[model samples]
Target: MSQQPAPRQGPIRRIAGDWHVIPGWLPVPDLGVLPVNAFLLAGPEPMLVDTGLAALSDAFVAALAARIDPADLRYIWLSHTDADHIGNLDRILDLAPNARVVTNFLGAGKMQLLGKGDPARLHLLQPGEVFEVGGHRLHQVRPPYYDAPETMGFFDPVDRAYFAADAFGALLPAEAASVDEIAAETLRDGLVGWSSVDAPWLAHMDQPTLGRMLSGLERLAPEHLLSGHLPDARGLAPLTSVIRHAYARGTTDAVPPETIRQIETLLTRS
Candidate 1:
């Protein structure tokens, strides 16, 4: 089956000083809208958090261009090798010939295996190492939950902004510009639901162990929690709170047998 087109346009919203977001809403079957987002670190380094959805390539490029000229982009941070995050990667590389793709070992290998990027333009990152771009130092931190092993998040000490690759994603009943727009219960349910689907291992995690993970983020107290699937969030409490509450007794819910079968069939066809 052909892929569905994502929403064409998403307004660029500023989350904090020099930190801006471009959010795209994509629809999922049986699930509501999922926010597919990319962030911009607008400063001396001028790095892009990730490329937006491929279905909205034109809009994504345009949104990114509006923030800063494609040629001016110095770094393209690949949070992971996931299609949603790396969708417009090549296109952006074409536009920003000077920008290097910053990613870890597995991410670079996946890009080569998938033929999605040029290795010559790749900057391989080491575990626990931080890179200094322009004047800002970006620390590599793994998110608590992710679907891909190559997944990595970035922490900006200057702005206290955390770019959580695929973690904290939630499927919402409707498109929201920010987490504050979502109701308390809806946000909780959506957060747990998406977590269950994206990282089923959560169901097997011990409560205290999970709490420690969630508590770690709480300790950071990021000014903005940037998620690939969630709208702009100002605080980590709202998100971490939901995960803690839902997973306290155990995981949220198990993936349905039918959904697994459907996925297996689709993979076979592909």
Candidate 2:
């Protein structure tokens, strides 16, 4: 069952030049609350990074309208076929008749399988392809970790903002307007904890390979790191450092003893 909380109507906060974000929170079982965010690029040709949660459909659409007229939206950038990310897609499409659904072939196919998205309105992007909307050049970036194979992130050269679909997400003890408000240790634990849940295979990944992937993002030198499940962040070093050390110990196929014990206890009780 979904652990998403009631939609919190929030103001659109500017993260970088012309890049605005609508941030909300979702409860993570036993871990705290995780941010559920969607970005808006206000420019000559406006675009939305991801549609917010279905639970907040009205508020999400209203938030977007507050930033820009729905009729003026030029693109709905689908990060993936994830429900949280695309919950209000059809609603937004109805509002923005001129907007096209920007996604990759796999993403389009998944939407087709789900029988939701309109094929005729899709603007399919090839791997490594850039989507130029007005003054901003959005380069497709696959994050180091993600829950979906078809997940697509983006790097905006104009603003030096990297929209990581689900990477760098964390669970915090409380709702934060910005990542800067989170304590260093809290952020570290949250980042690692959320990664453990969202990307369990991370425990089995080769450290060197993972390090290389993390390094690549470092090279991007993004001024702002935008994560779907993270509050607006201007720094990437802290987040990367946490990931680096957390997985430094290397891969393990065995489940944690604590988890096994809990499962056994539950079975016995039942």
Best by TM-score: 1
**For residue 267, what is the lDDT in candidate 2?**
18
Most accurate candidate by lDDT: 1
**Model 2 C-alpha lDDT per residue in residues 1-270, reported as the tens digit of each score:** 864344465778888899999886665434457688889999899999888777778888888888899899999999988777887889899999999999988999999997867899999999999889979889888899998899998888889999998899886888898888989998877787667756777878887898999999989999999999888888688888888888776423223546434422321220
Query: Cα RMSDs of all predictions?
Result: 2.9, 5.2
- Per-residue CA lDDT of model 1 for 176-235, tens digit only, reads 888889999888888887788778888788888988988887788888898998988887
- Model 2's alpha-carbon lDDT is 0.81
The local distance difference test score of each candidate is 0.82, 0.81
lDDT, model 2, position 26: 62
